[model samples]
Target chain A: MGIVSPGFSGRRRSGSELPPGQYLTRDFPVLSAGPTPHIRTEHWEFTVTTETGEATKWDWAALLALPADEITKDIHCVTRWSKLETNWKGVSLDTLLADVETSADYALVHSYGGYTTNVPMDDLLDGQAWIAYEYDGEPIDPEHGGPARLLVPHLYFWKSAKWVRGLVLSDNQDLGFWETAGYHEYGDPWKEQRYAGD
Target chain B: MTTDASYLDGNAAAGALSQVFAMDVTAAITQCNGCGQTGVFAESHVYVNAPGLVARCSGCDGVLLRVVTTPSDVYLDLRGLTYLRLPNP
Candidate 1:
C-alpha cells in the first residue's frame, strides 16, 4: 500500500483492463535477467517431451510446416503493466499436440540461454497457447524473446516465456524461475495473484 | 531499447519509483558491497519489466536492490549495497 524500499516510489494502477493492480503501457519494454541470446533460426528447434521421456521435436523448417495462425490478444504482466492487443503468429498448441499423447498435467517451458517457466498443461491446450515466432508482423526481436517464444496470453506474461526453446511435460508442477523466487505459482492477473501468499 | 543490450539503466524506472520517493533515488551514489564498485544509482542495471524491479550491480552482477510491490504491501531489500548515500541540499 506504500513505499518502504530505499528511496523508491510506486506507480498507481487505474482502468478496467484484463487485470487488477496493473497500469496500461503502450511501449513494449524489454526485460531480462542477463542478456538477449541470439538464436539463429537455422539452429532453432522446438520439442515436446512427455513424462516417460518420449519427445517430438521440430526444427525451424519443420515448425513452419505446421499451420500458422495470426493471433491478437491482451497480455498482462505481474510487474503491473497490461499491454493489450498484442498481435502474434505461430502454431497453436492444439496443432502441435494433436498427435502427441501425454497424461501429464503440467508443462515446464525451457528457453535458450537457460530460462524456464511452468504452466498448467490445460492452460496450454485447446488453442490456449502458441509457439509464437512472430510479433506485430515481424520476427520477434531477440530482446523480446524472438526467433520463438511461448505465447500463453491468459496468464501473467511471465508464463509466456521469452526465448522459449521447448517444453518438458510432467505430472508435477515444478516451479520455474520466478515461481521459485516467491512469485505466485499460478499467476492469474484477474485474481491479483502476484506473490506467493496472495 | 535495442537488441544491442537486453537491459536498460535505472533511468527507465524513474516514473514508477517516483510514486513513493519524493526525490530521484536514481541520483543517489551507491557502493556495491560485493565488488565495492561505486556509481550513481541511475548507472546500475535495472530489470524493471518483470513481476518486480531488481537493480543489480553492473560491476559484479550482484543484486543491489530488490523491490516487489503488491496491492497491500511493499517489499524492498537493499542488502547488496554497503552504503547508499543520497544527495540533498
Candidate 2:
C-alpha cells in the first residue's frame, strides 16, 4: 500500500472546491512545453480570426483600455492539482468577441511559442473566459504566461493557453499540439479526461 | 496537471528519469526511429500532463520515450528511439 505524505489528505472536499482525483495546491506550479517567449507590451497584440480569415486585432494598450474585471475562481489542472480562489485581472473574451460575428463552434487558440489548443466557442463567450494579464494583483510572471493568457476556468488549465496570441474560429474541431499527441480533445478535469481514450 | 497543449522539453524529464537511471538522461543523445534525427534528449518535447511522462522527438514529434509510474512499478517505453547514447559520469 502507498503511504500518504504528511499533511496531505487524499480525502475529497465537500463542495466544488476540489475536483475528482485532484489535490489542492497552495503554490502555483510552472508548466510549459518550450522556452518562455518574452514579448514586449508594445509588440503585444491579440487577434480573433474568423473562419473566412477575417481578423480582428487588439494591441496591448487597446486591450488594457477596455473594461476589465478582477475574477476570483478555482482552477484545475489535468495533472491533478487544483488551486482554489485564485485571483486574476483581464478583459473578458466577451468584450473581445463582441463586435465579431461567427457561427463557428470551435476555437483553435494560438500562443506565441507556436503552441495551440482547441476550445468550444461557447466556452469563450458569455463571460466564461478572459485574456488575463495579472495574477494576485501583480503582473503575471513570464514563466506563468505573462503579457496575457487565455483563462478558461471551466476546463482543465491546459486549455487556458499561455502566452496566448490569437483565436482562429473553425467550423470543425481541430486538435492542438497536445491533443494531436494523445491528450483528450475536450479536457474536462471533472471527468478526468487526461488522455485521448479517457 | 498537464494541459492539452502545454508541454516542456526533455530537460523537464531529467529529474524524473534520474530516479531510475544512474546518469542524467536528458544530456543523452537519442536517435529518432521515425525521422532518423539525432539530438540531445533535452531537446525532445516532454508532456507531463497525462498519466505519464511522454518525450517526443522535436524533429518529428514522434514519441521517443514514455514513463508511467504506478503504485508499485515504473514502466518505461523507449521503442521509438533507435538508440540512446548516455555519457559516462
Candidate 3:
C-alpha cells in the first residue's frame, strides 16, 4: 500500500492516505471530476487495419459474443495502497488484435475520454491487456467507467483508461492523461513510477 | 424548588449566542488502513469518537483524516455524521 505523506502538494489532501501502487480508484468523487466521455453506438467501431490491403471491424454487439475471461488480481494506485482483490471480465487484447496483421511497429489506444496511450506491438501481443466490461463480479458502473475500460494491470493504473472506446494502430507511442502531467509515460508499479521522478 | 431555582438562575444564558470562544482542534497525521495512504483522519476529534470514517483527498485520491482529539492527540476518521463544535462568537 502507498503511504500518504503530508504536503504531497495540491494533488493530495493535507493528511490523506493513498492506496498502494498500480490500483486505480474505485472510490467516489475521484471519478466524478472529469467530463463523461461520449459513447456513440452508430459511430462506434473497433477497427484493426494492417499494412496490408484489408481491415477488420467489430461493432459493439459483435464484441460481446467473444470468449470472455475473468481476471482476478491486486491493483495498486499511484496515490499508494493496493486493492487486494478485484475482478474484471473482457476479451483478451491479443485475441481482439489477432486478425489484423499490422506491419506497424507500434499502436495507439484511443478512448472516448479524449485520452490516448501508445504501446509497442510486442507489448500488445504479450497477452497482458484487455477491454474490460465487468468489475468485481458485476457489470462496471458508469461512474467507475462502464461499458468498457482498458486494463493493463502490468502498468500503472493510469494506463488503464476509463470509458475506453477504441484502439488506433499506429507506428509510435503517444502519451496520455497523467503522462503529460509529470507522470511516467510507461508506469511501472514495481518501479514506483507513480510520479514523474518515481 | 427554591434551591433548585436559585442554582439554575445562578448560571446566566449565553447572551444571544453573540460571544465568541477561541477553540483550536488538532488533527493527527495518520494513514488509511485500507489504502495505506498517509494522513488519514483519526478515529476521534476534539470531543467525539469517529469509528470507520473515510475521506478522500482532492489532489491524489488519497484518504485523509478530517478531525482529531486535541487533548488526547487522538486521530478520528471523518466519515458518517460527526459534528464539529464551532468557535463561540
Best by DockQ: 1
What residue runs in model 1 are displaced by over 4 Å at the alpha carbon?
A1-15, B1-49, B53-89
Q: CA shift at A19, candidate 3, in angstroms? A: 10
* TM-score of structure candidate 2: 0.72
Candidate 3 ranges beyond 4 A from true positions: A1-33, A38-44, A49-55, B1-89
User: iRMS of each prediction in angstroms?
Assistant: 4.4, 8.5, 21.5
What fraction of the true interface does each of the listed models get right, in terms of native contacts kept? 0.31, 0.08, 0.00
lDDT string for model 3 (A27-128, tens) is 422322233444554555666655453667877788788877667655555545455446788888778977666777766666664556655666656657
RMSD of each: 10.5, 9.5, 18.2
Ranking, DockQ, top scorer first:
1, 2, 3
Candidate DockQ scores, in order: 0.18, 0.11, 0.01
For residue B67, model 2's alpha carbon misses the true position, in angstroms, by 8.0
lDDT of 2 by residue, B1-89 (tens): 11334678789898779878998898899999989999999998897755468788888666788776654556677778999998767
Docking class of 1: incorrect
Return model 2's CA RMSD, one decimal.
Answer: 9.5
Q: How well does candidate 1 score on lDDT at residue A86?
A: 78
